[model samples]
Target: MARNQLLNITIWTALLAPVVYIGVMIVRIQNGEWDLLGPEPGRAVTQFLGTWALNSLLLTLTLSPLKRSPLSINLISYRRRMGLFAFTYMLLHLLAYMTMMLGWQWQDLNDEVVKRPYMVVGVFALLLTIPLAITSTRNWQRRLGRRWKKLHYSVYLVAALSMVHILLQVRSSWTEFVVYSSVLSLLLIERLLNRQKTA
Candidate 1:
């Protein structure tokens, strides 16, 4: 197939992998294979979805830098789909937390958010992603014109906050935080250097 077509297939396959995994988790839970998911499946799935969402966000941000590479594919065109997928995964992450962790108890969710600093940061990031996802379409992009680029810069902040969210939750391991932070820093620096060269 064509390049875009191949990219599309790859994107869909990447997106589907999480869905299939989640389905298997649910099936195992229903089939009394709960040991596989440990004691708290909701918590397990929530963390998994959050990690996937963050990974998608990283890929979305990485596309711009990839386009600067001499060997880059037509990946820039795929950024929109990648961003929307990030938002979709994050929404599922929140829902999974609410359903499994809080048992859909609005009061407990509210209390948890108030009591937990990390929740506030993480939820704020997710909330910021909402507008980005909504306006990711061609229709919205055309309408917004120059302002769209300005608005989409929120992704950088969202990524930072997401890193902080996980960082605060880690008790003993700093390795993941170090790796993600370094990668994000490099991407941000690359973007800035490119902008300066263009200017």
Candidate 2:
């Protein structure tokens, strides 16, 4: 197969794998095969989606630095798609939390947010991701011109807020915190070094 075809296949597979896994998990849960989801299926699904969203966001951040490496494989072209997938995962995470944890009680948002300040940070990160995802198109790039770059820079903030959100979670382990923080720090440092070299 051609290299581009291979890349497309790889990208689609990576993107769809989570969706398929979660779909199957949901089916299993519906079928009373609770072992897959364990006890408290809602929390399990919410955490699963949240973790993938964070992973996807981190992957999106890695694209620029990867493109600078010898093993890039032209992956930069798919950064926008990766970012959109990150947002999709985040949306699902929020929906899962709302439906499973809160029982879809919209009015409970205030209490939940107050009870868990991390929810505020997570929701804010999601809000920031919305504009970036919406304006990710080539047409939007052309229309926004220089402003587009500035707007998309908010992704760094989103990434930081996401880390903070995770750190604030009482159930988040130190190991998880260290791993994510290390990855984000390394990615940010790579971008800074690259900027200095270009300057």
Candidate 3:
């Protein structure tokens, strides 16, 4: 009963997070709360959304390892929710970038793409998630059969590309980069070890 309650809480939290965050940010911005958002409030919003998206992806990766742990709580059912949330966050991040950064300027986007290759990497990562999110249903899972697992393996690539996209940006500190890379590395190492054990 407790586990089920926890799951419900978690799922509801995930569902409401993005909506609540955007709503709060919009309200704060309307009230002239510039201090919290920095000088470039638009950029700050874009970064915040992108960070949450990456966070969701990392959480998705953690599920498999958690299931293998002694204290596992059977969170596998929520994996699809996490993945869909990640994609939704990424979509919002892209929209934020378009509206906030580019101001919906296609020419500017083209120039920015040429100058900032990291944006391309981020776009690719977002693109990769689309198919995964679409085929997350049980019907598609059954239809894909053995190929489903293989297709989903692209998620690791998305994570790697996302990390690279983040590192490519001119951040004031590399601390977040180090933390993301460390977690991803640990997850990958755990997966490799598990594969070896099973082999």
Which digits, one per residue and each the tens of the lDDT, describe model 2 over residues 1-199?
5988998999889987987898899987889888787778889999989999999999999988888888874578899999999999999999999988999888988888888999999999999999999999999999999999999989999999999998998574588888998999999999899999999
lDDT of 3 by residue, 1-199 (tens): 9978987897878766776887698688889887767889889889889999999999999999999989885779889988998999999999989998899999787789988999999999999999999999999999999999999999999999999998999559999999999999999999999999999
Greater lDDT among 1 and 3 belongs to 3
TM per prediction:
0.93, 0.95, 0.93
- Please provide, for model 1 over 1-199, each residue's C-alpha lDDT reduced to its tens digit, 9 standing for 90 to 100: 6976987898889976996799788888989888787888878989899989988999999988887878675588778888988998988888888888888888677778767779888889999999998899889999999999999998999999999998888889899889889999999999999999999
Ranking by TM-score: 2, 1, 3
Scanning candidate 2 in windows of ten residues, the lowest lDDT window is 169-178
Off by over 4 Å in 1: 1-3
Query: Lowest-lDDT window of 10 residues in candidate 1?
Result: 69-78
Candidate 3's TM-score reads 0.93
Model 2 lDDT on a 0 to 1 scale: 0.91
- What are the per-model C-alpha RMSD values against the true structure? 1.5, 1.4, 1.7
State in Å the error of residue 113, model 2.
1.3
